[model samples]
Target: MNPALRLPAAAVRTAGAVSPRLGAAVAMPMFAHVAKPRPVSDDDAPTMSLARGRTIRIPGIDRRGVDVAVYEWGRGPRTVVLSHGWLGRASQFSALVRELVAEGCRVVAFDAPAHGGSGGRRTYLPDWLATYAELQQRYGGFDAMVGHSFGGLATLVATAGEVEAARAVTIAAPADVDELFRGFQRMLGHSDAVSAGLRERFAARYFPGDPDPFSWLSTVRRPLPAGAPLLVVHDEGDRVVPFGESGRIAAANPGAAVLPTTGLGHNRILAADVVLDAVVEFVTAEVARHPVSPTTEAAAPLTSRAEPVGVS
Candidate 1:
C-alpha cells in the first residue's frame, strides 16, 4: 500500500482489463513517468548561502535539445563531483558542500535531465550519464566522485573509463539493473507477459543491439575498474534501494569499504552528520594521498572569487 506503488498498480489493473499487450503499453509509460523524477522547488531545499556556485546547460541524451543544469561550488585544489539521486536536486548536497568546502575541495553537482533546473519532461539513466559525461569534459577529471541512489549507479558507471577519479563514494545505491527492473515489476504487480513486453520495449528504445540491457547496465555485472578505491555507505532502514545492493558492490570489489548506518532511511542519509564526516574524511584523505602533479599544479583554478550565483 505504499503511495508510490498505488498509481502504477491501478494503471496495471486498468490495462490488464484489455489485453496483455495493452497492459504492457500502458504500464511502460506509467513506469517511465514514475521513474523520471519530479523537480524539487527551492523552498523545499536547504539554504544555499554558504557556497558560491553557478549553473550551466549541457546537451542531454540523444542531443534531443534538452539541457542539463550543473552547479559548481568552492575553489579548492582538489575537485569532487556529486551526483544526486532520482527526484533529487543539486542543492540536496548543501550540507555536504559546506563540509567539502571547509576541507578545501571544489565541488560540482548537477540536476539530471528532467530534474531540478534541467530541461525535459522525461528522462532515463542514459540521460543522467550523458549529463555527467558532459560535465566531466567541461571540468576535466575529478579527484573523487560521490553519488546517492541512482546517482551512485551513474558514478560507478563513470569510473569504468568514462571519467577519471581516484576514489568514489556511493550511498544507498543499487548494484544491479536487473534487481531494479524486478522491483519495478513487483511494485506495479505486472504479470510475466506484461513484464517481458515492457522489457522488450525498454531494450529496443534504450539499448538497441545489446542482447541483454539488464546485464549491460548492471554494476555487478560490470564491476568497478580494478584498483579504483570505493566507499559504499547504506542505511539499514533504506526502503527505496535495499542495503544488500551496497553489500553486493562491496563483495564484488574487495577494496571497497562498507559503512552501514541506522534510522536515516534513504533521503535523510544525505543530511546526516556522521555520513558527511565519513565522506569528507575519505575524500580529504584520498586527496592528501594523491597530491597534484607539478605539471598540473600550475594550471588555472576552475572556480572564481566573484560572487557565486544561486541555481534555481
Candidate 2:
C-alpha cells in the first residue's frame, strides 16, 4: 500500500490565473534543465562507441504521424525496450542502453508522442499506449522493459494483457494517476474543480481506457504478466515521485521485488550506477532464465501493467 503523507498546503495554493496549458510552457523549461539528459545523435543509433539503429513512423489514431527511435547492438539473443519518463526522450536512457548493449542485449526506445522528434501537442496515456502497441505489433515480444517516472506507469499499462514480456522494471514510477493530476494542478495553482475538469477532458480525449485518475489508483492497478518476474526501484529521497509509490507496486504484486533507494531524486536515477545495474541485472537474469525462442527473438511485447504510484 502507498504510505500516506500530509499534502503540503503550500503545494496546493491557487495562482491567480495560471492554466495547466500555460503551466506546461513554464514548467517544461524547468524540467528540461533539471532533467539534464545527455546529448544523443540525430540518428537512432549511438555515436562513437554507440551504434545507430532504426526509426519507424507510426500513423496515429488522430491521423497524425508518430515516430519511434530504435537502437540495436550486441550479439545476445534477448531484446530490451527502454521507456523514458515524462517530457523525456528515449535518448535519456542512452547511458543505460549503451551498458545493456555492451552486455549483448538489443535495445529499443521511443520518443513518445510530443517529446523528442515525435510530433504532437500535449501527450496523454492513451497516445503512449497506442504507440507502444504499434511497436509491439512490429517488433514482437521483448524480454524485459525498464520505464522511468511517467513512462514507468505507461509501461505498466502497456504491458498488461497485450505484451508477452518476461519481466518489467519501473524507476521512480507513480502508484496513482490522480496524484499526478493533483501534483500538476498544484504546480499550476489550479482550483480543484478546474483541475478535475481539465484533467478529465484530457484523459477522455487521449486516454480512453484510463479510469478517473482518482479512482484508478486502486482500480487500475497493473497486474504482472502471468509467470513474469518484476522488479521495482525507487528513491525515498525522490522529491518529484514519492517513494511510497513504489511501495504500493510491491504490495500489489507479491512476486514483485522492490528496492527502496536514497539520494537519487527522479531523473538522476537514470544516471545512477546502482539503479542501472539493478535494471541490467534484472533483465539479464530473466533473459538467462527464460531465454527467448530463436524464431520469435527479434520482436517486442504488446504491453503490460503494474500498479501505478504518483511521483510528480
Expressed as tens digits, the lDDT of each residue in 234-301 for candidate 1 is 99999888888988999877789888999999988998989999999989884322223334211322
RMSD of each: 7.7, 7.9
Over 188-288, each residue of candidate 2 has an lDDT whose tens digit, in order, gives 55456556555555555434565543443331354554445778999989877778888787776677878878888887788789988888888888443
Going through the candidates in the order shown, the clash numbers are: 0, 34
Q: State the lDDT at 181 in candidate 1.
A: 68
Shift of residue 299 alpha carbon in model 2, Å: 22
- Structure candidate 1, residue pairs in collision: none
Stretches of candidate 1 above 4 Å error?
3-7, 14-19, 34-57, 287-312
